[model samples]
Target: MAFDEGDAPGRVVNGLSVDVEDWFQVGAFEGVIERDSWGGLDDRVERNVHAILNLFDEAQASATFFTLGWVAKRHAGLLREIAARGHEVASHGWDHERVFRMDRKSFAADIERTRKTIEDCCGERVIGYRAPSFSIDQRTPWAFMELAEQGYLYSSSVAPVAHDHYGWADAPRFAFNPLPWSDLVELPVTTAQFRGKRLAAGGGGFFRVLPYAFSRWAIRQVNRDEGRPAIFYFHPWEIDPGQPRVAGAPLRSRLRHYTNLEKMAGKLRQLVREFAWGRIDVIAHREALRLEAEKATLHRASA
Candidate 1:
């Protein structure tokens, strides 16, 4: 019962996405745990994810979930529940490894493994990938070519805004195909280009940590000024403040993940009400070809 484009009350925003991994699997905490130790946790991801799904159901919204292959393999039913509810199931990678951390062979293999796992779960060709922590920026440009070769039509992996962890400080705010890679659509997370600096507008720890009015104004500027759709993303755990907290992590990382947990659900509700948002695939279906063609035109014009 999700709302269609015409049904939403506000200006139609682009897409909404969720990174579907357990709280501990997040890249910010990756440095804290031994690789094998991550499995020892009791996999409360579905419990957390279902909460967000319930919220979306209440809002009459459809979204995309970038699922980890490890989570999908064990919780195929969870993946099915997502697809059953008419949301898109995309890949977050096999084990949530950042692209720059792995060589090309390992990165490609991870992508293939995750794509097959998700395809098996959903019985549809998975066509998108969101890199962990937006790790596939300029440092790992090969990711775009690899995603194109693997038949992925779009990537929402570039953050564009500068962050302590990752950002392509030079990338565009609106969707665009980078030089030499026109086949894959690059949907950088929505950020407003302000006074020569790119400030993140959509969800991230920044959205949670900063004042909500700032986020609202940023999206408004993007739509009114740029005439481009904005992208937003969030995590299920953000809505669940009472979830068990991880121990032994750095003070800063713990604060980043846990602070304002109680406020996330309310902030998200305000965001959805203030702007129109839809599933990523819907945006991709509409824009990918046009973007590719636009790139070709630009190339021809330059030549």
Candidate 2:
């Protein structure tokens, strides 16, 4: 399908988020690092997250932290710190389990566990969720119902780009309701229309691998040209270039994970400074308001 053309004006606020997981917990390292041995690894998540908090504070930007159930269980204080420091805390599911790898029951339990753990730590409801690897595509159509049922107001788990590991190539690039009967919003991570092709313009490895100038241009396209809020996310470990490396991992995985580590913080600072950033909850609330206004307008048109 063709990309959604921009209709609104240029001044749009984008959403910033962090997938709060340790360096060892990433899917790229799952092959080399077993879950049982995770505890023994050097954990830089807390220190890295604190550094991120400091960065955001310096930039005067707000963001959402989609934390893991396991991470929250271990770092309850850090979870609370994220909330206390003026950012929203949401769910990134138990561990880094992908949605397509589980049944409905398991997925539901995972979401419940993650959300409850985050709320318990922060003492605030976790109404937003992002599937571990943006795995809520064609295979998991029922995922939205589960999220809505579990009291989640929205999800940012789908990136509408073509990819080998994760991407719903045909899904809408912006936020939309996947279910007709529910109000749950699927807020996709940002992607850019590069010469009629959808490409990863959001955060993560793509943001790292690509030139900062291109990333900057794409985000400006989404904000000023598309007139929609772009959702960008990265992990706490991305900034921690000094984290221990996983030996004997796939060359691609190692490259994807480790590349641009030293450059991540500088690029992030520039990106944050260049655009307006806010929490995912704020974006969801604005989406709700926009939908309501559209409904009202349609009602008036019919009357």
Candidates' TM-scores?
0.92, 0.94
TM-score, model 2 to reference: 0.94
Cα lDDT for residue 124, candidate 1: 74
Candidate 1 Cα RMSD (Å): 2.5
What lDDT is obtained when candidate 1 is compared to the true structure? Answer: 0.83
Q: On a 0 to 100 scale, what is the lDDT of residue 52 in model 2?
A: 97
Q: Give the distance in Å from residue 259's predicted Cα in candidate 2 to where it truly belongs.
A: 0.5
Clashing pairs in 1: 13-276
Q: Over the stretch 67-146, how does candidate 1's per-residue lDDT look in tens digits?
A: 99999998998999999998999999988788889988899999999999998988877998899888988888778888
Best of the candidates, TM-score: 2
lDDT of 1 at 99: 86
**Considering every candidate listed, which one attains the maximal lDDT?**
2
